[model samples]
Target: MSNQEKFVVSRIIPAPSHIECVSGGMFKLADGCPITVISPLAEAELSATLHDTCNVYWKATPSFSFQAGGEGIAADGYRLRVTAEHCEITASGLSGIRNAFKTMRQLAESERGVLKSTCWLLPPVAVEDEPALAFRGIHLCWFPETPTWEIEKNIRLAAYYKFNYAVIESWGMIRLESHPEYCWDEFAVDKKEVSRLVKLAASLGLTLIPQLNLFGHATSSRCGSGKQMLLDRHPEYASLFEPDGWTWCIANPCARQYLTELVTELHDLFDKPPFFHIGCDEAYNAGSCSLCRENYPAKLKAHLMYFYSLFAKRGARVMMWHDMLLNRDDPRWEGYTAYGHSSRGLDELYKELPKDIIICDWQYGYPEKDGKEPDWRTSHFFKQTGFDVLVCPWLERRGIKSLGCLAKQEKLFGILETTWHWYRGSFRKETLFVIASNAAWHPDWTPESNVVYREYLNRHLREMDQDMKSKKYIQFGSVQYQINPAPYQD
Candidate 1:
């Protein structure tokens, strides 16, 4: 056996470190060996996955023994050691223990036919592991009538790999009681569905953050995810400018009031995690309204602060898409939707907006670096401009080594892997999710070989696919055709 073969080999996602094969012989389980748990969260987790994970169903002798003495464990770290008599796991935190069970469940896979048979063997080894980044997450863009089972499947896959958070970029999914006219019935899901999703995610230790599209991105036509019903019903709410500025009239108090009510409704409904993502990207028609027309620059700044304050007052940590305030010095910014226009001044947005609000910097393409669109200097500028930056990427496929590199820098909260097109389903995303999940968990990982990474990702995905098949999930995604709008502006 090779020197590396001495360590226990794990097909577990987000691979662990400091692995060692203490015994060459396979460790067999004795009947009714107790699992010692130092955390209550671990207990609940073990109960949830115990049945489905392992083929053998040996009932534990005792429930739990809570005491803490895990010295080297990170925030969400674990230490596991398996031997002949008993297998034990120790972690400093509840999440760590939950994670340890996931690996153990994989390790306990047995080829033995009987449930009571203790023939399954994971080599006796001691392993110590923890995540590199505090925030490891994936982003899902929502379309009209997203199935509840579909949502559950996505969340289940993320949790299985130990990914911590999921951001659903859906302004049209859930029905808001205050504005029934704003969302179409086909697109709007029931409150009960949302509740079920919340509970399901919490059970898996994953936090679901709903992105509320507030200011801008509103139109009565095709080619946009903006809330158009509000504008169709109330044309006065439309922005002041021309050239089809698909944005709300930020100058209008009624528009602001309308969004405020919506925000309040969302706050009262879920109210867990206390974080809100206010979609303020691509507001090309900033000063388009009558009230906001005069002193456009000042009004833009005021509106920025005003919208930000609405959430800040509710004691919710605010998050916003940073394209509107993009500071790319490169010429490639022209093609970008958020570039130069007859709109509000973005030159001073980073300076004017509050420092606490997280800047979700999403760069879909423009792969050039150095002096390119958002090079090192540009990223440093955002950091210096007093913002907690999150490196967002349209990671439909392929690992984002650039974002991973940026994540190592200061002032960066973490990385956000965005799947912009709802139609573009799990095919590419499954592969990307594995890479993003690994990148987030292990910040110091070297992207030495794509072949190795693909193999590692495939192994974890194969196991997940089996789970999905067993659960009888309809394994398919349809392509949603884009609407071709009339050439005329609304």
Candidate 2:
């Protein structure tokens, strides 16, 4: 058999759009090989990516040569050619070059029968690739219990997997300068840390969009816990939220001003990205306050539009969860997860909301009554009503596949994979990241077997450890311990 027939097979994740194996000897990637880039814009990125590659495969960093122009390559696409003696990359932009290097890193494998070796081998092939969707992203949450290192790992992993955007929603973890009491004193992430993460994501060709719960989740804590981040300690500020402190009190002028300052602080902290996620989901107590009840849905409408206009002036477009815009009682979405109750009258706001406001429709499962795959009716509803929509899925495989397929087939905005509390533990985070990355990159690619999936995930985890310079054995695997530890010490 030819060298191409013996070595070449589909190994890269979100598999490349096009790949052709050439009949030649394997490319020996020895230490200190030369990496040439034809675009100056991609030089810095190539250096950063190659640093990781060198650490993974060689004892010394490869030499770099930069040139001027790449005419035919797309801004977000790349063409790569690998031969026995050379590996050439052609791209017009930083993102394309970054992607090309990522593909190369994934394809590299250690030389056989060599332990602790620095050399690696690559099959002779030519590849042309680019993401299918314009807004491919993953939504990650930083709760009070989450460690900063874990957040950094997730951000780096998302970028390494070629995701163009990441929505970081901090749950009582971001320290607000204006309102010091907004976050937990013990676990709050300060502005410096936030800025560092933003810069890190930017360096890796990933845009980090800030997410704040403007409507519901006023306490910046989960509903099940019933622990309020603000009111729990500063009961004096109770008027700013509903009686239960679950939703922000939109009727109160002071509450509106407080939220405005918080948004401004976070926006500036994140370097003011083009998109901001103003979470408006599961607002069960939206119109409960006496003043808010007097105005009903109109007050809510005005409150949301206020931020919409605020973001517009700041050169940003607003994104909100789609639950509040959908009526739970509507027969059209009988079996879907729609949280807009008729009493709150939030579904009516869909017509009034600005069409430019991107709707993030999150559905974690198929309809209870519907057949196997989810219909993704809510996303279609938003699109049919003249709003650009993103289909979000949590940890469900079928839901991820169905929503991703819908996004591709309907030409919707994109897919946003949410990793709320799952990022903490339980191996769910890794599973979600792998599946979501694959689905978003190529909705038509066949799902890999469990064995192959686990292998890719393990390699990803190991690469992350190398990138972070992790030393402890506990930090090596998906979980810290092989088995759950005892509950408490004596």
Candidate 3:
């Protein structure tokens, strides 16, 4: 065995200095501190080894050293060597350590490595890094009853790709009746489990943002005997109903109280950041209720003002969808807080909301945009708008390929990829949720570039042939094109 092979390598370390008898080196572990030391070459190889874990590590040779950093194939470990002046972690070295480092810097400014095993080298001095956008992130897991492997995988890839924020839309965490764990009509949320998910996301250098629905899409509230359904109890607060059976409501005292309680609980759960997305879109029947019809404009204005006061008191920056205020013909979307669309209302929305409030324009999978189309058409317009925008996409097969192409575009702020199990089935089937997630994180990463993601998905499908499948599977017998829209979707 070589001299470098004699010692049991607990983990790689950065370059070390030997003044007296004691040697100082860096190692891999969470928190702050070093524990052991291996060979000088082992320290250099730490960046290469970092691929096996999501945590950060330090690399050290003799003359040069660097924190394991970079993204894409380059960051995976094309070049890893330690030096006196710099710890070189190349683009192709150690599973994109460059990308990882850039992402880490966005989440937390820390000098510490994974563990305190030994004195480790710092990242290479010559390395250069930057993000594709400002709002890169992964969709927070909504179904608490379901396994979080998909979302966990999402954070892992988000870190790999360089996304900085994570937005969660969990029904289970909100103590709602629709969640599977409800017992005897009681509502509850698993706070510890939710915390575990948040910590994991944070460790990956992804900011955690909770998404709370304030209006419309309250199916969760109607689950238990329709008792908690604001629409059922306070019919006056319910949104208008369309002839086509679409339901809507307003911010009456009853609805406001319910929403307040929910927001307060959520605030207690996640107290890190002051920014919250008060979902107020998709109000199908905003003018149907008698009260809403009598005072439509006033109610709308008061709704926003009321929440602005409450959210401001909590020290939170606010974000919301601009759909309710968008005037298709008019240039203005009407003054509103942060607004979002399905990659459709960029031009008008940017003109309406405060510049500081972010815009989340989603494009699920629509690859092309002709004239007057909602998705691609709108995205083309947003390219020229001076506001920050986030592109949201889905995790299905079609969504994966389409979004990979979108992520390659440089003008957009960042992508918000989602692993949705809504309107169809459980999310357990999308086994490669993490792979698609990389599209948002890595500008260079594409659906075609994700061999790991493809292989995992193939395994989950049991290697079927041309037909839909032997039995029922994710891809089915054949492949079909999925649609992409706006900067938001499941």
Q: State the C-alpha lDDT per candidate.
A: 0.62, 0.81, 0.44
Across residues 368-398, which tens digit of lDDT does each residue of candidate 2 receive?
Answer: 4544565677888899999999999998887
Better candidate by lDDT, 2 or 3:
2
Better of 1 and 3 by lDDT: 1
Task: Output the number of the lDDT-best candidate.
Answer: 2
lDDT of 3 at 438: 44
Error of 1 at 210 (Å): 1.9
Q: Please state the error at residue 111 of candidate 3 in Å.
A: 31
Model 3 poorest ten-residue lDDT run: 10-19
User: Could you report the Cα RMSD, in angstroms, for every candidate shown?
Assistant: 6.0, 2.7, 13.0
Q: What's model 3's TM-score? A: 0.55
- TM-score ranking from best candidate downward: 2, 1, 3
Model 1 per-residue lDDT at 246: 70
Best by TM-score: 2
lDDT tens digits, residue span 1-490, model 3: 2222212110111111110111234222233422221122345576344433323332222222343333343222223332232233345432344443432222221245555444433321222333334455666555534334444544544454455676777653345323223212123345676677677666555667877766554543323334333333334433333222223344357656756766666665665565677765555544555555564655555666676677778887666554544444443322222233323333232453445444555444444435321234343444555545555656445555445445456456556665554422223333224434445433453232222333343332222222112433323311211433444555
Candidate 3 achieves a global lDDT of 0.44
Whole-model lDDT, model 2: 0.81
RMSD of 1: 6.0
